[model samples]
Target: MFDESVSKKIHVPLVLSMFIGLLTILINFFYSVEDIRSEVYSSQSKELRAAYVNGLREKKVIALTNVINLSSNYSIIESLKSQDRNVAIAGLQTLSRKFKEQTIYKNIKVHLHDANLRSFLRTWDVEKYGEELAGFRKTLRDVKKNKKAIATIELGRAGLLVRGIAPIENDGVYLGSVEFMQGFNSIVKNLRKNREYETAFLMKEDYLSVATALSSSPKIKEFVLAVKEKNVDKDFLNSLKGVEIEDTKNFQISDEYFLVSEPIKDFSNVIVGYALIGEKTSMVETVIAKAKSSLLKQVYIIFFIDIIILIYLIIIVRKKIIRPIVDMEKMAQELSL
Candidate 1:
């Protein structure tokens, strides 16, 4: 009874120590899980950035290709040669309708400039013409000056646009340039549909005076949620009130959301806006949950078996060695007496 009592006393302290050890392990395990989640998000952000940039490049090429082809149309050429406004308007109206029906490039605006880089015609707004474009129309000026085609992402009175300007030459004499332009809406829409990324184009307040397309959409602080921007919910968009794109590579709006913002620049290397890409953390959360559950289960089972083995070894030592020593000490005391 005394030996059994002694064994129970030893086990009490051992069990307490084991419990403290287990608690420490659990704290470390959770911290490691958090680190794993951070690594996964960091890796995925690079991929998201790559995909977004690639999509932009492809769109630029497509816009430039369409403009070059349109510049070669026989009727457009004839109208340019004769400087006939009425024929040019009719021809462009017909072409615009055909463009709408035949391509994803609906409502593509075609603007014609004279040799002096003066705005001669605007197909989208027939009445808004004769504006002298020598000051800000660099793309038009480049094509006319070099007698070659040029395309770029430019900011104008209309807004930020993918514009392609091609020189019109009849018998080695440069007549003018034809500029074809399109917006960023389709590009954003495609990224959302294909990559499961919620994207928003946040335009600078300075551009609001010139970028008319962004003026009416939605405002979040000083920046405007451009017409090209897309988010799944209005509340999610509202949550972006103070998102600063400079110096921040990625940010978290909530425990379950991760966002990365990249700057959007114009042809002159001026920062025009930002492209904010966001994604949910469902997959990362699932991985963490599974890892935590498995770790706890394994630790508990191992500790339980370890404790049982430790107790058995202690009992054996007491029976085989400790009891003998105690008995000999008592016998010596009796002999001495």
Candidate 2:
């Protein structure tokens, strides 16, 4: 009798153990599948971001080159080379006004280096920020020396500007420099007008905030400044670290972020800047929420099927196995008694 009771107790536990083991196996399988799905989704998101950034950079370069080519026309250069300041200024104003009207440029300005081709045209605001113009002067000197048709220049507080310097040669003498200024704002506005993504910024080698589409809200400005201070290079490095496409691994700025960056090249295909695109974490979170909702529905359906299968298996075990074992136990008990 004692042996029979012991066997029944062990039998109950063995059945429970088998049920638990089966449940564990199913749970692990589902968990692993979920992990894999998340990983694949993250990777795809990264690739998409990188592609978008590179495309924007390429577009900017093309647009800039076209603008440079237009600015380099001999007629435009000759008008600026005229010895009369009034004629040169009038010509420049007319060209600037016409270019602004026809093209997507904003605040277009022209500078001419003087008859000596040494001192460049000084804007009214130059005196206020004389220190800032030094780098621009240096860049102008370099462009003149190298005779580069298109180039990127850093103009301290004026921000980074794309310049097209076309030398005007009247007779055999080099007359002056015809410098075209396209503010970084134009690029920012262009991107904003065309692209749907938020947080687009252009960064130079020094990580200066050339132009940003960030909101005018103080909070946003503060956040941007914080980002600039903390990880300017780190952020830029993360974007261009890879061979072609660099996707930062779902970094969170304030929330979850999807970011991609690509180097900006000039007409000569030299990297001069970087274009960065960022999507807010909230957007991804919304996607995840929707996915979870769908997943839950699937999970519920699978769970229902699992429950039905478990119930069927339990019924079969009870009828074919447990009942017979119970009958054997009952017979042995009767014999012992």
Candidate 3:
């Protein structure tokens, strides 16, 4: 009977007390875990943004270098001066083929433009020539005006192009400009293959309006345009209903999709679009898995201490209260007899 009394009063309350401690620890640990995850995602986003910038910078350097090489060629310069499209194509046709075989520089478009910004010859589209670019080819005009090599991301009739332009001159007179351009798809898809991150180049409708693109581009948002080779899926695009395309810093598309964005500018330093860099939330989950293991270890330690505390309370109750009550009842009964 006394053992039953001890269990009913002492053991139950002690278990409850132990559980309270455990519950508090679990709550606090979860909050801490959430903080850790936020910090990790923010840090990773910054790193991804840096990687994206470096990729653009590297592409710019290569474009400038190759454009300079093309402009310095006597044959290409002479061909541009003579307006002989055939000779210009023959001079760079082999290099164009080898550029396609590259790991990331495929779809390179070689354009020969006159000083009037008129399309003279295009290696990518040879038959289409004599198109007046005085209206939309701002980068080529910039190279012609500045008389220096230039490279940047620009909107073209073909879509977004990473272009490098160099002035072609003979006898101190500018004949034309030669261009080495790569499409955005080539770069974004390459980033996915190399860095294992999804990316999209979002162009504003206002900016895209100047160039009559050869193909129809999808509308990601009200006025935002996205390339067909986007690594982000339609679900992520659907999530952008009310979100500003430029406000994608630490943006989470879903439970499993997270993205970070940086604004992209053209040759005139105009903000035309955004570059979204993202990875699946599985990346965050991998880091959190380790955190959860540590949290479990802390919980186990606290639970062990709680068990010991519960055992000590049970011993105290039986010795100090139960035994005394039993002896007192026995003495009273004997005296009554």
TM-score of 3: 0.73
lDDT of 3 by residue, 1-337 (tens): 7557755786687778778888998898889888877777777788778878888888888889999998997768878888787788887887767777874556667888988889898887899989999887777778888899988888777666688899988999999999988655645666778877777777777765555672366776644555664445565555555455678555554555667778888878888788777777787678677877887788889889888877887788778987787788778889999
Scanning candidate 3 in windows of ten residues, the lowest lDDT window is 222-231
> Which candidate comes out best when scored by TM-score?
1
Off by over 4 Å in 3: 1-31, 101-106, 229-243, 295-337
- Candidate 2, 244: how far from true, in Å? 25
**lDDT top scorer:** 3
Error of 1 at 30 (Å): 4.9
Off by over 4 Å in 1: 1-32, 228-232, 254-256, 283-337
Ranking by lDDT: 3, 1, 2
Clashing pairs in 3: none
TM-score of predicted structure 2: 0.53
Q: Could you tell me the lDDT of residue 276 within candidate 2? A: 56
Residue clash pairs of candidate 1: none
Model 2 weakest lDDT span, ten residues long: 217-226
Q: What is the Å distance of residue 50 in model 3 from its true position?
A: 2.3
Candidate 2 local lDDT, residue 170 = 55
